[model samples]
Target: MIPRMGAGVVRNGRELVKGMSAAVPIAIGYVPIAVAFGVIARQSGLPFAETVLMSMMVFAGASQFMAVQMATAGALGMEIIFATLVLNFRHFIMSLSLMDRLKDVPLLAKGALAFGVTDETFAVAAMDEKGGNGRIHPLYMAGLIAVAYGSWVFGTVVGGLFAGVIPRSISDSMNIALYAMFIALLVPAVRKRWRVGAIALIGMALNALFGLFLSGGWATVLATVAAAGCGTMLMPREEPPAAEKTAG
Candidate 1:
């Protein structure tokens, strides 16, 4: 339904809520993994507050887990920063992809939006493209990021405060959520687009090959760039649907 000027506020509210609803699956996967990260950080001799603070600040799952593990081993500050910088190199690509898609979003808002573009959020936003307007609404993007960002911080607090209280077996098993969430997102897209499936397979193969010699960070970046190039050149491009003209 088209909203009157007065209803703009209500329309915005609905879009925000809708975006948050769409991210529930992501939250389910993230919370458990975040909790595990918190437990591991605490057990690895990180202070409880710092563990939660890391989640709030870094917000990158794999990097956070790796950083805590590295820190536990008595790594130097510069070493930890360099390792995380390498690990999170993929964020550069993710940020660029989002920037292109969100042409209508405000310039000031883009930075905040980019900060929230994790792997899961990027996947969901890409799949949920706003075809009609050719741009995602800023409020929707905000809500999506809010859920994911909030869940990680909240879970960290829970796990940090009660590190040993949570059973190690349960924390260990939470890793399954990570894989399961990817499969859940992947199957639907692959069913609709064979090219997506093919590109995914190629990425996996290239990552495996590169992993043999390169560090995981470098391997992932290279494989992703290669697979993206493959898709760009090989996949058939479809133009956006034309907008229907209406009498003014």
Candidate 2:
């Protein structure tokens, strides 16, 4: 059997409180960014109804931003739809892991909860500790997701309502918040593989190098390709333990 840990335990009321507390900065940072998304969507000629509908339906911050951008760029509807599918393909893997953790829950409840499985929610849920009996509480996972869902919905509304009031410089500064959120999400995962860390550093360097040379969004696309290549090449593979010799 794979080694197990209390990876899903809240430990106590305090740990639950701590996890919720950590989510506060995420909420605050998301406010301005979500607002920017709404403003941009509105500027792109999507009416409030359509904008809100996309937010509610898609429920993915990055994918929604990318979708709006592609739409604004006059990409075909099929292209936009395909791009969203490719971008969220990771969700399938995350869902499998979440399903194992939440296997004991009722099917209806599991189906409803699965809708909230975003990157942030998946990260929180994946880290929940296993219990002595190896079952993790679905409620803890739900609690984590509920906290993030509140922030996302609330931030979308705030951004939609106050988009015009946000200044250009303030909007520029918000980019740092995005970087901060990425780092916060990344650091923990980095501990598992030095190659992962190295690839990230290399990707950042290459992205900067290409950003200086190329125009438009080529830098991001190139960096993503480079990172994927590096990860596939350098990430370690685990080997199965040898079977014990039979006693003579």
Worst 10 residues of 1 by lDDT: 239-248
lDDT of 1 by residue, 41-140 (tens): 8877889988888998899887777676556655566666776776577789988887887887788899999989998898888777576754778888
Model 2, 6-111: lDDT tens per residue? 4434254555565566456556655666776676666666777777777777778777777777677666677666656755767888877787777778988887
lDDT of the candidates, in the order given: 0.80, 0.68
Q: List residue ranges in candidate 2 displaced over 4 A.
A: 1-26, 167-194, 197-230, 240-248
Clashes of each: 0, 10
Best by lDDT: 1
| TM-score of candidate 1 to 2 decimals | 0.69
Candidate 2, TM-score vs. the true structure? 0.67
